[model samples]
Target chain A: MLDQAQPMDEHLGFEALYCAHSDAIYRFCLRLCGNPTLAEDLTQEVFVGALQGFHRLKNRSSAKTWLYRVALYRVRAHRSRHESRNVSLEGAAEPRSVSADAQYAMRLDLSQALATLSPAQREAFLLVKCQGLTCSEAASVLRIPVGTVKFRVHRAVNSLQSVLSDTPEASHEM
Target chain B: MRCSSVQRRLSTWANESHRPQEEHRVQVHLDSCEACRQYQSKVTRLDYLASEFKPVTLERDLLPNIERDGVRKGSGYVPRVFFARHWVAIGAAAVMILGATMSTRRGGAYSASAQEAVRGMESTELDRTAYHQSLWQAAGPHQEGQLELLDQVWYEAGKWREKSIPSFGGDRIFEFDKSSGLVRLSRDWRGKIISQEETSPRPKQIDLQEFCKQAGIEGAEANAEDLGTRTLNGVSVREISIPTYNLQRTLVWLIPGTNLPVRMERQNEQHGSWTTSWLFTIEYAKSWPPSIFDSSTLESTTGGPTARASQPFHDAESGTTNESRLSQRSKLPNRNQPAFRTGNIVFAAYLSTTKPGPIDSACASERVAAQLRRPLDSLASEYGTLQSYGSDSHDTDKDRAAGSKDQVYNLRFGNHPVRSVMSFTLGSDGVWKATSLKVASSATP
Candidate 1:
């Protein structure tokens, strides 16, 4: 939130990167991994990995992007390590399908829809809509063309809308 | 409006197109058009509803705490730099001497401006040969010892190998800590549950296979195919991929650090792999207590499903006699080539010009009805495969291996979508095999 990437060389500077972005990263990871504990551990891991490979960081100014890249990359690697775990490409719940916890229901359906989209599409949508990255920034993080990133986001959004529309409540919500 | 034009406008307005001038026209047109207006409303609703998918924001204070804990404990990357100035070296007499050097980003370690540090750094002399020699061998004293330490850790961990065995297709599992010279093998059954997730299928059908069985997968059919070699996280490994076998292709990365495949993957056909990259080194727990290996993975496949059958059985491929020759070649050294043959037979059954004649001809054991006909009464379904009007033997009967020597029994499919799916055959060993199973007609690309 506050130019979170600390000065690369200073002892205090390194601490600031963690202070600034760790929680945001942890939260992002929790949503991605669908587990709070794992998200927390992964947040630790992402930073640890960043530390291990910190010397490779040629430009410190792009530290925020770099951190996000590391977090997302670790998430990807974790997904791959447990690669066979099946996360179906189908809607999990509808808006009406979630009544007890309205906030949770919405999140569940959003997650459900996001899970259905390809990984690239999900990353694009999250980076642009949720994390508030510009298409270019998201593209840089993803190392894809801006046009591809835009396409992925649009496709993800359209599919998510369709997945949500499947529920009678999402239909009404729609 | 043309359907295409309407679709474009609908897409643009749904995206909240960024042009101010066009916004007026779109809004005016949408206001008049109920269908378009309904679509926009639907889209707006979706947007409000989309936030549910986002992660919960962390408490503002969590970062500082984590940062504080992480910095001291974290590992750092240092770089390769030398203090000798080329100009200074050339100008100096026979004696070599240097004063000091300062810069940012050196020796795989991140450091701020060297001049700004609290104390001026001392340049320590490094012996090049000795440093290289130490890498092949471990850096510390305990490096050259037996894995007694890790064995003790595995014994105490309790879950040494119970959890992870099910995930793999029964390949050797080993982990090496370069820092510590310990190689933990799964005593014919050992591994840690590195990760596990419950499968949530939307339609809630029974899973693809009953109870993720460690069914007797004879051996890894993985061999050199579309191969790629590169050093991944300092582990020199070879990565190979096969496009078919299932909707998702399989990738096996064989780590040179250990002769085993350290990583495995099943990538979706469409997006390839979302997480194939960014795989770095696997960090072990700082220390494993002595109680790790007390638990057991011995009966994992023994009782549940494959207990009795997992023991090597003669399939159409297994090197046993009861099975036919065609099935045996399907298990050739060129792993995919043989499977490619069996898959061809499977495809042929799907695309036979003659139906009902022989879904499986080799099962006949001996010469039976040479002229088997398709059951025309049964409407051709996707399962029966689109049968045509002739047999494969009817096409030419000439083969390079046979030279018209042996007769091939093939039911041909006519009026087919692709000319490629027509031809099928057995190998030089008289095993039923096909060139490739191309189901491009299914629109799966």
Candidate 2:
């Protein structure tokens, strides 16, 4: 939770919020868009939009969730305008931590499996499992009920299981 | 607890704080059941992978980029130069409007003059432009030659929809929506969808630049030879041949008028002679049917109802319904409308820096034609041809007056200095004709 004494409308307050939440938001955008350059652009756009509407942020404690809502909206708007097609992890720069070829292949396969899930399920699952957000927190970010978030995440897991089961060796490739 | 219930609890167990009793029951079920144990193991593996996959760390601080765009740390001010400048800066190549024309195709030798033609090819907006292509593999003449259809692709904006015609299974349609970051693959047999799967979008070889690199021998561009013009399917196309050191040959056929590639043929040196292996034939489109990109909604040309009338695919994030999107597409200026036709002709004339001939003169009255001439010549002389044009609605009152006898439109030509207002009237031949053009005062912001 942010310090309530520092108002988000001011420069120092916003900077504090930005410093605290920018990396999380950036990671979320990258997962959503699959393009580092575009994700960075969207991250910048999210902050700009959030700063403009800072006054509407009534509860300073839920600032991270609020920023996520703004990021999702900005990403959807960008998609509508550009009509961009498939951008895969294959095109992205290789992650420095990953050294083994088998592990890299497994990651690619996982990416392909994740794509099979519905948009709603994917968003829910990413927030809870990948982003380390609780179901309640993700529900707040998505503006859906907590039960719905759990249901979507459950369905996403089942779907991933079904997809990965086709190539059982994928998980064991590493 | 059953395996299903245990798996559900296990999926969200990390995110939820459950009761001790419920947790104990789940643990007991997992210990007793091997299937549930495997499921838990799979879940754990996926969790590890999902966390490790990408494992994104910030490459550069975005706070600075955001701050540079007027979202200051302690301030509430955002400048008007917000997304447009930043978007264009990053996407300059995507939005660049080139008025590139084909140079005269020279014969035999690869000279400096041919470089102009190569530059024209490179500058062509093949990626940004909307096009449909048919991939075919041709057998040799001695081998009872026939062109086998491998795949057909329709591309618009950044979205690509490809149909792979394989011999084993039914035809499959793979759609890659870049905007939504989704790839939908559907199988269709006799215009009926057998099965459909939506996956994460992965890019295929839809780019000519990428295709050239893969098809050509290394440094094919440097050693390219211009083979001049050849008539293909009744249209004249210029051929550029790039032969590799490994006895591989790639011939690219480009339409002379638009400088867009129509076909690329790859050949191999077999028996000390070139034999064509496969070719990709491209067709450019002004616009495509809305349903072409969505396989679930596509009306099959094979006389079968490929569309599932019960459920239409909905893009929830776009905030616009498919019906609404189709309606919005319908509202755009009909290319066949005489007024729009005249506007297109005038725009084309402006592009070529040439005076309109009899056809253009026939569409306008003497007064309106005279009014259009001076500014057209001056703008053409100073700015060259306008790269792009779209209907601008800055003046709502002017647009509201549309469909009346004297219709007014504020058309903004891209890559220009001014935004001009054009007025049209119905001609005697039941076509809307340009009546007058107002320029000079409407300077672009």
The CA lDDT at B81 in model 1 is 23
In order of the candidates, what TM-score does chain B achieve? 0.20, 0.24
- Distance from true location, Cα of A166 in model 2, Å: 9.7
Per residue, candidate 2 scores C-alpha lDDT tens digits across A1-174 of 011112222212344456546667888887777788988888888887766665565234466678888888776666656555645333322222332454445444766666666667877888877775778778988999998999898888877766655333422110
By TM-score, the best candidate is: 2
Residue pairs clashing, model 2? A11-B73, A11-B74, A84-B178, A84-B179, A85-B178, A115-B199, A115-B200
Real A-B contacts recovered, model 2: 0.33
lDDT of 1 by residue, A1-174 (tens): 000112222111333345445656776677677777778778877776666555554224456677778888888888776655766432233222323344345443676656666777777777765664556667878888877877776666666665565344311110
Please give, for residues B1-445, the per-residue lDDT of candidate 2 as tens digits.
8888887777776566555567569867876998977776566556645655424666776755676664455546532111111111111111111111111122222234323322311221224232211111111111211112223334333333333221112333433443443334433333433344443212122333333442322234676777888887788877888764345566787676544555655565544556443333444432222233432332122210111111232433234433342222111112223322211111111001011100121112234333344444345435432322222211122223454233222222223445456565545664445555656354443
Q: How would you class the docking of model 2? A: incorrect
Give residue A106's error in model 2 in angstroms.
Answer: 5.3
